[model samples]
Target: MFINVSDESITVNNKWERAELAQIEEISMYPVALIGDVLQRLGMMASVIRHVAGKATFFGTVLPILTWEGDNLAIHRALDDAQPGDVLVINGNGEINRALFGDLLGEVCLARKVAAVVIDGAVRDIQELDAMGLPTYARAVNPAGPSKYGPGQVGFPVACGHIVCNPGDAIFGDRDGIIVIDRRLVSSLAAKLKLQDDVENNFRARVRASLG
Candidate 1:
């Protein structure tokens, strides 16, 4: 269920299922690189989208926002529907000339308990965002600001960082980059992630023993 407010140039989808808290917690134990390995490296976002500020890792259900190039009016509107465990995944059309997110929005996200933010564009205020410790990543950084005039959509599928992201999808991000997982796959992938993690841990233990 979604609402299209033509006058406002925004569309909001009101219905999507979030994964269980336990499931999200279970998956968060693994690194983003390990999860990508388990997924056969299919869901990893482009490397150009690097961690810019805040914590290095975060995991949450996705709240996808698609905005016009270099504009972020949709993001402001999307926050009205944001939940604590939600991650704001914005597809800013890969525009890096203007920052679509910054410290002000970072504060808002902190207050709302947003799990993380990944922008397929640009963001600014790196120092404040880092101090605030909200996990944030983007394609680039520019001090220039963004336009509020929106022709955008929220809760819709967005192509962020060269990968398609659907609302309610599970997102895990780290220093390497972001990965999108389907909500339906969380349970099944959780087991695979554990198995792979165990394999890597054993390998590391073996290497340490050899070194000793």
Candidate 2:
């Protein structure tokens, strides 16, 4: 059940089911690194995609957008379909020369109640973004703004940070980096994540006792 809009330039798929809110909330309690461990270290985005501004933690269903390098028309269209808990996962072809997001878009996202933003490219307006408190991550920062031309895709699968991101996939990020979890795997990973957290907590406690 996907809506496809095709033209000479841009394409969009407007339909995908989000993970249950309860499931998303439950997974949010675990650390992103621990979740990656439970996924056998296969779901993490590349370390190059670091936290660039705002809060360091965010988790929500992905809304993937693919845009031409140095262009951002598709990003604007994607927002039209955005839901309250979406994380805009943009694949800007890893182009660091031009920023694909900034403070004005951040304001729109906040108004829309978007959870966060992850870009495999660049972003600008760091001070404004940080003040706005929208969790944002990117490969770099550039003062160069993006062109608004088309030839992009929205609500489709995109390769970002060397990992494939699909709309409706659960994405989590913190200081460590970003990780994607398939919607189907969300429920199954909860117990494993909890157990690993407990183990790590106990190990840290033992190290503290030795020091004492």
Candidate 3:
């Protein structure tokens, strides 16, 4: 597996093993509007990456940045090296002119057991991808194809909305929005998230009784 020198220590561990992951996934199944309120209190932004028109939740490590107007070399490389719970985050500037992904790449990712892909760009071959049950989040859908030029970077920090993502940062996305959580902060954040849930549940019960 190819790895950048700086990310040598970044072992690809299954973050789902952490109790926090299950907790987060459980919370995510709730109404997104409610989740947004919780995220706001937690000081996290929900980065939206809409597909052409479908529903799916994507969770994985952020392999940040696939340079605009260039090939997906870094993405391919990252896919080769990525473990099961890794997402390929391509910052395409929301360009709908060209497709950043297709069935071929998706197949490789599926074979490798990649978690999902989040693109602030275009993706093609929607039906095939959907049928395969591959979780892909992108800004738009266009038949336009991307250039396969050489040169790109991986395992580095990149931007998605107002957040910066390192290669191994845990990424969570559903119909609501994409949330990037720093792996180091998971333990602490988990505690706070539970508190938020408790308050919300209490509020729900009160509202229910009022309605009755």
Candidate 2 local Cα displacement, residue 68, angstroms: 0.9
TM-score computed on alpha carbons, candidate 1:
0.93
Which ranges in model 3 have alpha carbons more than 4 Å from their true place?
1-48, 53-55
**lDDT scores of the candidates, listed in order:** 0.89, 0.89, 0.64
Backbone clash total for model 3 is: 0
Off by over 4 Å in 1: 1-7
Residue-by-residue lDDT tens digits, candidate 2, 115-170: 99999999999999999999999999999998876789998899989999988999
Q: What are the per-model numbers of colliding residue pairs?
A: 0, 0, 0
Better of 2 and 3 by lDDT: 2
For model 3 the local lDDT of residue 139 reads 72
For model 3, state the Cα shift of residue 195 in Å. 1.4
